[model samples]
Target: MDPISLILGAILVGAAKGSGDVASGAVVDAYNGFREALRRRLAGRKPAQTAVEEYTADPDNWRPALETYLQQADAQKDEELLASASAVLSAADPDGASHGKYAVQIYGAQGVQVGDRNIQTNNYRSGP
Candidate 1:
């Protein structure tokens, strides 16, 4: 490969990785925020009533905001966004796999298998 092509490829990869990181961070932050809010509510601390209104006032909703950041980080490449979103979503799930191929068995009243469902699992990992 030409030097320029190699450099471009490296840049693209770096951007995708960065986008994934940003998306993952945003999701984690949102999760933490929600948890804190819940804790405060449970503790009898009344949350601001306008919080939801303020959130909705933003042009992009929560998920869309994170996605916009990811897209910008990846130079607006559809493929890059798809790849990064997959990575971020996987990071949010238990198996660390980009796609869902896992199932959770549901039990009935008598502990009999009733059905199965797919659930999103959020498992975080530190650096190797």
Candidate 2:
């Protein structure tokens, strides 16, 4: 396989494994801050310096405002958020089954079955 393919595959697999929700709030916060900063910039203001400085000065003050913005945006649904949280919990498991299970299912559906044998050869391999 090409090196790029390998890297891309790894990234997809990792993303499927999911991550904890601990940083999600922070991500939403930063996203809102940046968006707000852009708005300020477009309105003829120093966004990067002023907006970021104000945000950093009192994150608590921005939290409620960001939450309100998110609520109004309707970009993500409650089910979607719950799914994300579940994925995070599943990925944190020590057994590969939790995260790897989904990958295995996808591979199986695509007709790439892994048998009891340890060999990694694909079914599509050409033989003499």
lDDT of each: 0.34, 0.35
Could you tell me every candidate's TM-score relative to the true structure? 0.21, 0.23
Model 2: how far residue 17 lies from native, Å: 14
lDDT per residue as tens, model 1, 7-122:
22222323343344454664554344433432333243222223322333442334234333333344223343233333333344536343342222243433232112323445
The clash number for model 1 is 1
- Candidate 2, after superposition: displacement of residue 91 in Å? 4.7
lDDT for residue 123 in candidate 2, whole number 0-100: 60
Give one clash count per candidate, in the order shown. Answer: 1, 0
